[model samples]
Target: MIWHHLFQPFIEFGFMRRALVVCLALSVSTTALGVFLLLRRMSLMGDALSHAILPGVAVGYLLSGMSLLAMTLGGFIAGIAVALTAGLVSRRTPLREDASFAGFYLGSLALGVTLVSLRGSSVDLLHLLFGSILAVDNDAALFVCGVASLTLLSLALCYRGLVSEAFDSAFLEVNARRLPSLLHGLFLALLVLNLVASFQVLGTLMAVGVMMLPAVAARCWVRTLPGLLLLAALGGALSAWLGLSLSWSAGLPAGPAIVLTASLLFFISVLCGTRSRLADGLRAFFN
Candidate 1:
């Protein structure tokens, strides 16, 4: 009966099945990216880039009303533009990279909100900000899956370069020459793509939570990169399942529910994880 209660909603509803599939795909793909982001200390960059895509999404909505193709394209273009511009400003000017990114993203967020308020209804704006995973149709599912597939493939192809870049930028730059810059750009593109895909399911504001939280949680337990990636993916998938179940049983919104589940997992890991500082301190105190 417990199993029935957990499994029945997905079995009976097509949307639930689709959400599970999409969320699983997201978990596997985005969490892998998150691992690299965490190791590189660019965790907050994901949050900045998430907001940076807003103006583009708004522009897409203005042009085509809720057309997925238009919005996705717009968001991707905007994200890439902001990333590149931030990099350029940081490199050419005296401003720090993080500061450049923050300024650009904040401005982009304001522009996006203003644009959407001008032409779109409150409901439309809410949909863009909060997403409606339970209402996802076939086309959106396919798009999300396609992005996930590309993300995994790209990660595989760039694994060595990404690992090198994350751990030793100076070594990578000295030994590999242009490889460091190339890899940075490639990684940024992939990050943008993943964020765009996730916005369709988790909303732009909350998408990075799904990406970063699981990886942070996994770090508490795993020291090796491979182990971290594996555990983070598992964490994301588990969050998807538990979040969807809670949403169904309690009439909660799906997006926040899923992210909240990930947050819960993060806190639990911090408290009980063997490698966590809290656990280490407690052990030393007890002994």
Candidate 2:
């Protein structure tokens, strides 16, 4: 009975099966990248970067009239621009990185909203902001898979540099193959790419949750950086499974349902992970 109820929806419906594949793939990329972001003390940057893509998406829609490829490409470029500009401003000016990120993201978001409003109905705007995952077609799914593959490959290549820069900037400057700035650019590129892909599953506004919630939940239970990434991947998988189950039964929006499940796991980890014994075991496994 338990197995039947749990697996029946997926077995009966192609959409559910596709959602599972995409969700699992998304979970891997976002959660793994999220580990780096958290360790680098840039957790909040996810929120800013996620919103920063809005203007680009809006411009793409305006120029191409809602072509998925156009909007995604535009958003990716815009996100990179915002990240680079913010980094530059923080370096040259008295402002901190967080402040600059906030300033740019706010402006970008306002511009995006205005542009979206000019020619689109509230429904169109809502779809962009909140997403419509059930409507995701094979083309969007293919794009997401491609982005996920690239993100993982890039992260693997930059692993040592990312860790070194995250823990010790001076040491990283001496050791990293490319300058830390180049690594930073690569990291932001991955961030924007994930956000664009996530927009298909969770909308621009909510996609950040997928990256954030699982990463944070894992942190509650782990001490080592590698342990954090592994546990975060686990948390993301759990969220995808539980969230899909809930959405199937309740007729809820799949994106929010997934995020909410992740949030619940975060709370559970916080409550149960005081001593981090489970995390210690995980660290040992990796070691």
- Return the TM-score for each candidate structure: 0.96, 0.92
Give per-candidate clash totals.
0, 0
State each model's CA lDDT, in order. Answer: 0.93, 0.88
**Top candidate by TM-score:** 1
Query: In candidate 1, how many clashes are counted?
Result: 0
What residue pairs are clashing in model 1? none
Q: Which stretches of candidate 1 lie over 4 Å from their true place?
A: 277-287
Model 1 over residues 93-139: C-alpha lDDT tens digits? Answer: 99998999999999999999899999999998888888889888999
Error in Å for residue 138 of model 2: 0.8
- State which candidate has the highest lDDT: 1
Which residue runs of candidate 2 sit more than 4 Å off their true CA positions? 175-178, 274-287
Worst 10 residues of 1 by lDDT: 1-10
